[model samples]
Target: MEQTQGMADETRHPMTGNRLDAEAEASGPGFETHDYDVVVIGAGGAGLRAAIAAHDAGARVAIVCKSLLGKAHTVMAEGGAAAAMGNLWPDDNWKVHFRDTMRGGKMLNNWRMAQVHAQEAPDRVLELEEWGALFDRTPDGLISQRDFGGHRYARLAHVGDRTGLEMIRTLQQRAVALGIDVFMEFTVTELCKADDRIVGAVGYWRETGRFVVFNAPSVVLATGGIGRSFQVTSNSWEYTGDGHALAMRAGASLINMEFVQFHPTGMVWPMSVRGLLVTESVRGDGGILKNSDGERFMFNYIPDFFKAETADSVEEADGWYEDKKNNRRPPELLPRDEVARAINSEVKAGRGTEHGGVYLDIASRRDPEFIRRRLPSMYHQFKELAGVDITQEAMEIGPTCHYVMGGVEVDPDTQQSSVDGLYAAGEVSGGMHGSNRLGGNSLSDLLVFGRRAGECAAENAAKHSNERAAVPDSTATAAADAALAPFAEEGGENPYTIQKDLQDVMHRLVGIIRKREELVTSLTELEELKARAEHLSVEGNRQYNPGWHLAIDLANMLIVSECVATAALEREESRGGHTREDFPMASDEWAQINLVLTYDGESVGLARQPLPVMPDDLKELFD
Candidate 1:
C-alpha cells in the first residue's frame, strides 16, 4: 500500500485534547523543555557522526542513546572500515571500490549513493585519523589497510581488529568536546509530528519512568540494526530495531527487509554466545577452513559466480597470500555468503568436527606471532570464553545472523523517507546492500549517509515553520497507559516466554536458509506471537524492568519481522542473500525493481518500485 503522505488520522479520542492549553497546568506541566536545532537518537557511529555534523553546522544538538557513551555495539565490530585509502595497496581507487560494492550488493544498492559512499568513505576514515583514531599505521606512517571479503584489493583501514572501538571512542570524545549534550539511558519510543512534519520525539527516562519530549525541528535516526530479534546474532542488546520501528510507525516506506546477512565465522559452541563473531580478519591473516577430515573444503564450494577468481588448488590458494594477483581464491578472502553456505554444507555433510563445527585453522597456517599481533581481541575472547588457544587449536566456526540489508525506503540521493521531515541513516536505512553486505561497507555507510541525512534534515528544518497542531491530551495519556499496560496485565502472559517463542519462530523459519513455505509459516506464527505479546505480563518496577523492556522491544521486532517475511515471500528470485528454493535464480524482472514495504495497522504488505538507475556519466563507468 502506498502510504498517503499527511498527518495520519488522530487514532485517539479528541475529548482528551487541549494539552498545549494545559501547559500551565503543572508548574509549566513539569515537563522539561529541551529545544534543540537537531536531536540525534542512537549514539553509535552513525548517531555520533550525525550529531557532530549538525553541531558543526551550528545546530544545538543532543544525542539520545539507550546505552553508555562508548559501549555501543560498534565497539564489538572487528574487521575494519572499507575505504579506498591506498595505504596498503596504492592501486585501489573509488571507481573500483564503487564497482565492487555494487557487484557485492547484487546491484540493489542505490547507484548514486553507492557512488558517493565509495568516493567519501576514504575521507571519513581520514577524518577519524585526524580525530585521534590511532589506526594501525603503515611503514610509511599512513593509516594501514587490511584485506577483507568482497573487496578487490587491501583497502580496509583498521587498528588491530577493534577499529570500531577506536572509531566510536574517538567520535564520542569529540562529540563531548564539541558540547553536544548527550542524554544517555533514554529510549525514544515515538517520533512526534505536527501537520505532517516531524517536529520532535517523545521518550522516557529508563531510570525514572518519567516521560520526556525532545522538541527539535530536526531528528536523525542512526539507531543501528535489528539483529537482536533472532535467536543467534552478532549484535548487542541495544540493537532492537528502535529506529526502524519508529520510522515505519511514523509512515515511512521500508525497502528490502528480507536481506539479512549471515556471517560465515561465529563460534559454534557455548550456547550463551553461539553467534559471537570470529572476524574475517582471521581468514585474512592466513587461516583456512577445514572439514572434519582436515581437508580445506572451500575450494570445492566455489560456484560459477566466483569461478573466474577462485583458486582451484591448495598451492594456488596458499600462493595468493604473498602475491594476490597470481592466485584465484585468495586464502584471506571469499564473499561472506559463499563462505557461510560452504561451512553450512560441510557441517550438514558429516564433515563437522568434534564440537559440531568446522576447523578454522590459523595456528598451523600462519606464524603465532603474526596471528597474535593481528587478532588480539579474538585471542582474548576465545581464551576467556571457550578456554582455547587460537594459536594451537583450530577455532571451531559456523554461520551466525550478522546484518540486515533492508530498511526504511528513501530517495537514492537525499536519504529522505517517503515522509517529508523523516530521514534514516546507517543500518536502519537500507537498499545499500541488496542480498548481502560486504564486511567493511557498514561503517562507511553509517558515516556517509549519516552526514547526508543530517544535512538534508537540517535544511528542511531550517525552512519549516512549526504549525503546533493540537496534540490531544488523551493521545499522550493513552500512550503512557499503553506503556504501562504490561504491568497491568495480571499473569496473562510471560514476557520472556513470548519473546523466546518469537525468537524461535524467526530463527527456525527465517534463518540462514529460507523457503517460501517456511517463510509463510513463520509469518503465521509471528502473528500469533504478536497476539500473545498484547496480554504479556511483567514483574518488578518500571525502573530497569528487563522483562517489560523486552516486551516493548518485541513489538518492534515483530513489526520488522513482518516486513522481512512479507518482502521475502513477494521476492521470488534468489539474489544475493535472499535465496528461495522455489525460485532459485535471479530474474531480469527483479533486476529492475525493489521490494518497498509499508504497514496500514491492519496488515503489512509489499510494494514494488522501480530501481534507481545510474546517472548517465556513471553508467559508462559501471559498464
Candidate 2:
C-alpha cells in the first residue's frame, strides 16, 4: 500500500479550486476551497484513523496536516498500544484494564470512556494487523505483550521500540489505499462556523504563501497536545495548541486542563538532546533507577497509595522483576505521576547525576543482547545524539513535559463537542484520561475514540445533508487579514521572543509543582504576553516562513497556557498531574469535580461540574 504518485506529489490539490466556482457568485475573489462531509485536521494516528472510518462510513473525507504523510508526531511513541488481549496473563480482560485505568487516573477519569476504551482497544489493535501491520508476536503466535506503568498486567502490543512508526505507516498506507484526499503540509489556523455550527476550516500551505479552505458540515480536530507551551517538552513544533485554541474561539469548553503529565524518564544529558523522550520501555522491561551513590532509590519513594502492590526493598524490587506472581511490582514502575515526583524529589535533594538527573541503569539489570533487541531505538538515540553507549553505562534521565490530560471537552459516546458539528478526539480531546494517563493507553485511546469521532461526525453531517451550513465569506477574509498582521508591522516584538518568554513563564510558574503565588504571577504575566502577542512581527512573507507560522501559533499557546494556569489555580488539591506543593494531599471533595473552561468572545469563563457516574457493572469491577 505504497503512496501513489497522486498522493506523493507534495503541493497540488485540483479539488481546491472547485470551490472557486461555488463561491464566485457569493463573493468577489474566491479563495481556494474544497467541500467534504468531514474535514480532519492534524494527520496523526487519530486523524488517519478518523479519516479511514469516515470513508468507510460512506462520507466524502479529507485529511489535512502540518507535516508530510507518515511524519506525524505520533511516530515518537516508542512503547506499544495498550489492549487487554491476555497474551501473557490469562486472567486479564477489559474489566481489569478499565479498573486499572481508573485507579491510575486517581478516580478522576471519565468512567464510561475508560470502559469503552478498554473494551474496544483489543479489536482496534487487531484491526491494524488486519490492515497489514507487522507486530512483534508472542511465543504462541499472538501479538506480544509487555509491561508498562499502571497496567495490572503485561498488556501492550508492540513492535520493538518502534510501535508508533509501524502503526502510522500501516494507517497511512490504509488511508492512501482507500484514496482519502490528503492535503499534506497544510496548517489549519481557523475553524469557521455558520451561526453556532461548524461549517469549514481555513488554513495556509506551509510550502507556499496561499490560503485554502475546507468547507464542510463537520470538522474533526485530531490535532495533538500543547506540550510546546513548556520550555522542556517532547512534543514537536506542530503541537502548539492549534486545535485547543480553535475550539475555544469557536465556543467549546475544555475539561481538566490543569492536569499536565510530566514523563519521568526523558534524556537529560548533552543539553542538545535534553527533554527528548527516553521511553519508559527502558524501565518496563527490567531497567532500574539509581542515585549518584549507586543506590536503588525508587524503593524508598513508594507512596502509601501504591504501597500494597509495590516492593519496598531492593531485594524485593529486584526479585519482583523475575518473579512477578510471588512478589510486588518495583517502585520504578509506579504510575507516571508518582515516579516523576519521586525523580524530582531525588534530584532536588542532591542525589541526582551531574546533569541534574537520576540514573536509569539497564546495563547491570538486563542482558546486553536483550537490551539491544528490545531497546534498539534507545541504544541508537543516546549513541547518536549524546555520544553515550546505553548498553554499557547508565543514562541521565529526569522528568520532562510530555502529555496533557486536558483538551476539547466532548461527549464520551460521540466525541462531539458542545458546539454542534465540531468533533474532537485523541490528545486534542479531553476527559478520557482525567488527571493522569498511563503510558501505553494513549495509543489505544486514539484508535477507539478516533473511530468513534469519525462515525459520529459523519452521522452529524448526514443529518444536514439537505441543507448544508454556510460560513460567511467575510469570516475567512478577516482571519486571513489577522494572520497577515504580523507581516504588516515593520518593527515590533519578535514572535520568537514572545514564544520564548511564554515558554519560560509556563515551565517555571505553571510547571509540575505549582503554588498559588506562582499561578497568580503566571496569570498576570500571561496577560502581558497576550498584549505583546498583538504586536507579533515576523520578518518574512508567508512562503516557507517559519516565523509567520509561529506568530499564528503563539496566539494559540497563549490562550492554552492561560487555561492551564487558571484551572491549576482553581483546583486547590494535589492529585494526579496537578500537584500543588502548598496543598499537598488528594482531597475527596475534589474527586467528583472537574474544572471546565470556555471563552465567550470577551473573556474566559471557568466552572466546576460533577463527574459522570460509573455504571453498576463497571463499579463492581472496581470493587
Candidate 3:
C-alpha cells in the first residue's frame, strides 16, 4: 500500500521510536505493521469525517477501507442530508426536526441521540458548505432544502439528488488536505485487544494477500451496515456488517438489531438489477405510488399514528407540496417502514404491477425538464439499466433491504462503545435513528457523530500517550490462520453457495415482514449455515481473490444475521422496521425496550434493556 508524503515510515512505531513488534520482526515475512493514535475503518462519509476530526485534534490518524477511498456506499446515497436549516420554511427548527425523527422512529429511538443530532445537524451541514460543498441553492442564494418522508418541512440540504456524493467529496478532500494516512484496498478482519480494551486492528491487503497490523490506542468503526447479508439490497459488497461483527466479537453490545429498514422504492424489473435503489427524491419531487388498477394506494394505508398530520384526500395532499402551512402531508410521504409495508400488502393482494411491484410515476405529474433537472442520476439510472425512460413512463418499484437501525450501542454524546477505546459512528453505531431512520438523516448522523467519535478517540489516545499496546504475536498469528483456513479445505462447501443460501434465509424469513415461525426457522437455518461456513473452501490464492474475500466476509454476515434473527424473534411486537406478523400490533411494553445482543466467542446472546426516558422538556414537544 502507498503512503502519503510526510507519513511516518512503517518500519517503526510513530509514538515510540522502536520496531512495532519485536516477536514479529524475529519471525519474519509474515505481516507488515504500522502505528497510529487513532485508526478509522470503512472510509465512507463517517470514516473520512472521523479521520479529519482526529487529525485536526492533533492525533495521527489512519483510515483503512476495503475499497478505494471515495467509492464508499455513501456515494449511492441519492437523497439529501437532513438538517433543520429552515431555509424553505421559517417554522422549521431543531425541536420540530427532533420531534419528527422520534415520531418517525416510533418513539423507540435514543432520545438523547435524536436531540443531539437535530441540534447539531444544521451546524454540521453549514460546516460542509464552509468546507467547499456546493449545495443546491434557493432563489435567495441559501442552501436548498427539499422535502422527504417523515419530515415536517423541506429540511434536507442537498446538491440536486447527489448530495451524498458531494458530502463525501468534500470530506475526502479535507482529509487528504490534512494529510491523514489512508490504507486503501485493505480489509480489517479482526480488532486486536489487550486488557479488554481496543489497542489495534489486523487485516490483509487485497492486492498482495499480506497481513498488516495497526497498533493504536483507539479505533473507530464506521463500517456502514449489514445490508449485504440480505438478497435484495441497496448496500454495496463492502457492507458485510464488518463493524457490527467486529464490535460484537470485541465484547461490545449491539442494540436494536431487529430494526432493518426496507426502502420503499427499489427497481423491481430485470432480475439482474432488481434490488438497485430508486431514490426517495423521486417521491420528494412529486412522484406518486400506484398499484395495477392505477389507484393511489398510499391513501388507503395511512396509519392512525400519523392520521392527524397526514392528508386524507388527493387535493389537499397535492396542495401541501406547494403550500406547506395550510395543508397536511400526503400519505406517500410517510416513513419508509409504513410505505414499504403498504407496497408489500398491495403485492400480496394481487394489485401489483406486471413485475410483481408497484409503479412510481412522476412522468404524468411533472414536466420532463423539471424531472431531469431535479433527479438527473435517477433519469439516467432507469434509462441505462432498465431501458425505461422515466420522463415518459412509470418505473416499477418495490421494497429493498436498505439500512439497519441496529448497530454498536454507544454513548450518545461521545460515540464510545461499551468497550473502552472502541468507538463507533455512522450507520455502524446504533441508537441514533432508533427503530427506523428517516430518508436523509444518515449523512448528517455520520458527520455529527463521526466528529464526536474522532475527537473523543483522540482524547482517549492522549490519556495513554506514555503507554502503547502491542499487537500480541499470538493474536495476530491466530487471526492470520483463520483468514487463510478457507484456502486449506478440500471438497468443502462453496463460500458463494453458503452466502447465497444465507441471503435467501434472511430475505425470505426475517425480511420486511416477519413471523415467529419464520424467524425461528431462520435462526435454525443460520446455525446450519454457520456449520457449513466452518468448512467453507475457496479455489484461489488470496491475491486479489474475490472468493477468498467472500469466504472471510461470510463469518461476519452469519454473526450479524444471527443477531438480527435472534433479536427479531425476541421483539414480538410490530414496531418500525422490525415487523412481527404473529404479534401484529405495536405494544407499549415493547416500545419501552431495546433489544441488545452480545457475543461470547462462540454464540450470540440477547438481552432487553429499557429505552432511555425522554426529558420532560423534549416530551413536551411531542405532547
Candidate 4:
C-alpha cells in the first residue's frame, strides 16, 4: 500500500454544498462537474487495482461506482484466486499455469496477456498478503492453497470460500486509506469524447437525481462482467454491461462478446437463490457430482477431450490427486466447459433432481471437518440461504451465467483500446478470457492488466494534462440528455417487461447452447427491444428511480446482448463457451481469427480479424 503525492491531501466534494441549487434545479439540475487526471469507472477488483496503480504512478485518481465501496459483486466470488502457489503441487510453475489458461480458453486468449497473468499472479497474491489479507494459512503459517477446476495443481490460495470478499476488502481499505475519492451510487451513463479521443464521462447520482460529469484525460472502464442480461446469473445487479456499452457507443470496438462462461454449479432450487454460486472449490476438495441414480457421472463424459488426464476408475482418480507425480486421473480437475456440458447432459437424460438440477454431494466423499476447513463459506451459504446442511444432504446445483469473456478490444501489452486515450481492464476488457474464462483466472487478470492499464493511462494523462483540456461538451450533453430522456417520455413500454423479454430471448436462444436460427431470432428480438427502449417511459422524478435508470441500462444490455448473439452466430463452431449446435465442431479457420464487433444504432455489424500472433520465440515459450 504505497502512497504517492497524488494521493496526499486529496479534497472531497461536500455532497450537500455542491448539490442541485434552485437555478440548476430549474433546468433539471445541471450536471455537477469535476476533473481528475484519471477516472476509474468501477469499484470492483479491477477498478480498485487500476486506481491503486494510477495513484502509485503519481496521478490524481477517483473511483465512481454504482454500489457501496466494499459491496461490489466481487464480494460474492467464493472461488479462490489462481496463482501457482505450489502449496499442494511443488512442481507447478508459471509455465504450467499459462498452459492451463490457454487450453482452458481453447487457445483464444491473447498469448501475451495470458503469459503476463501466469507470471505475475503469484506476486500479486503475495502483495495482498502483505496488505493484511488473512488468507487461510497452512500448518507452517503460510497462505494455504486449494485446488480448483481447470488448474492442474492446487493453485487457488483462498480464505476458505470468501476469497473475493477478502480481496475486495483488502483493496478497498488500501484505497480509502490512501484517500482515493470514491463516489458511491453514481452510475456513469456515457463516456465523453472529443473528436475520437476520450475526455471524460457523465453520470447521475443514484441517491439524488443529480447529473455529474468527470472531465479526465484518461478513463478506465473496469465495470466488471455482463451477467444481468440473463434471467439467472451468478453476478450482482451492477453487472449490467454499462462499461461495455459506454465504450462501444463512444466508438471503441468490443471483442469476444459472444463468449460467456456459465459456471457449472449454481443452486437451482427454490428459484429465489436460483443463480447463487456454489464454488468450484468444493469439487476441488473432493466433492462429486451424482445423478438421481447416485452414480459419479463425470467418468462417462471424460473422453478424448480429457482422456490423457481423466481417471479411468474411482480409486485411480482419488489416488492421482494424492500423488500428482505418479498418478494420472485428476477427476475434479477437468475443464469447466466439459464439466458444465456433462451436468447438462445428465439433467437432459432425466437424471435431474426435482428442480432440474443434479446433486453435488460432498457428505459421503470427505470428512465433515475437512469440508468445513476448506469450504466453510459453501456450507454457510447453503445453510443460511437455502437452509440445507451440506454435511447431511446433497446440494441441488445447475449452471448459471458467471462471466462475459467479451469486452472492449485492447492491445495485448498496453491494455489500450482501439480508441486512443481510452483504456479498459478486468472483465470489461476482452482478449484475455477468449471463449471461456477459467474459474480463478479473473482475479489475476484484474490485477495483472489493471495495473498495466493504469500505468499506461497515467503516463498518457501526464503527457496531456499540461495541454488545454478539451472536455466534449456536445458528447457530455448528448449523454446527459439520453440518460434523462426516460423520465420525460409518456406511457409507452414497461422497463421491467422489456428487460424480462430480453432476458428470456437471451436465455432461450443465445444461452448455453446456440444455433444459427436461434441466434438470428435473438438478434431480431433484441432489435425490437431497442426500438421499445428508444421510446420507453417512466413515471417518476429522477431521485432513486430504478425504473428510469434501468430503462437506460437496458439499452446497454440489449446492445451487448446483440453483440454476443451476432458474434456467436458468426463464429460457426464450438470452442470453449461459444457452442453452436448448427456447427458442432471446432474449426481451424475460426481458430485462425477473432470476431470483431462494431455497432450502429439500428444494428450491430461484425467483422473478422486475425489474432495478433506472438513472436516466434514467444510461441516456443507458450509451448
- Residue-wise C-alpha lDDT for candidate 1, range 1-623, written one tens digit per residue: 11111323313224322122222222221233466777888888888988888777767788898876787888888889999977777788999898788888888887777888999999998888898999998888888888888898888888898988898989999998998888777778778777776777776656545556666767888888888888888888988888888888788878888888888898887777789999999987778888999888876765565544434434544444322344344643777877887887888889997767798989997787888899999998999988889998888888888888988877766778887677888888888777678889988887888878877777766666454333344444455566678877997788788778877887889887789899999989988987888898888766556787787787788898888888888888887778777887789899888888887765686779898768788777665
lDDT of candidate 1?
0.78
lDDT of 3 at 55: 95
When sorted by lDDT, best at the front, the candidate numbers are 3, 2, 4, 1
lDDT measured at residue 307 in model 3 versus the true structure, 0 to 100 = 58
* Ten contiguous residues with the weakest lDDT in model 2: 17-26
User: If scored against the real structure, what TM-score would every candidate get?
Assistant: 0.92, 0.94, 0.94, 0.94
- lDDT of predicted model 3: 0.90
Candidate with top lDDT is 3
lDDT digits (tens) for residues 107-218 of candidate 4: 8888888888999999999998899899988898877887777777778888888999999999999998899888887888878777678888888777666677788989
Q: 262-287 in candidate 3: lDDT tens per residue?
A: 99999998998988999999999989
- The per-prediction CA RMSD against the true structure, in angstroms, equals 6.8, 4.5, 4.4, 4.4
What is the Cα-based lDDT of residue 186 in candidate 3? 82
Kindly report which residue stretches of model 1 are placed more than 4 angstroms away from their true locations once superposed. Answer: 1-31, 309-327, 465-474
Model 2 clash pairs are none
The lowest-lDDT stretch of 10 consecutive residues in candidate 4 is 1-10
lDDT of model 3, residue 60? 96
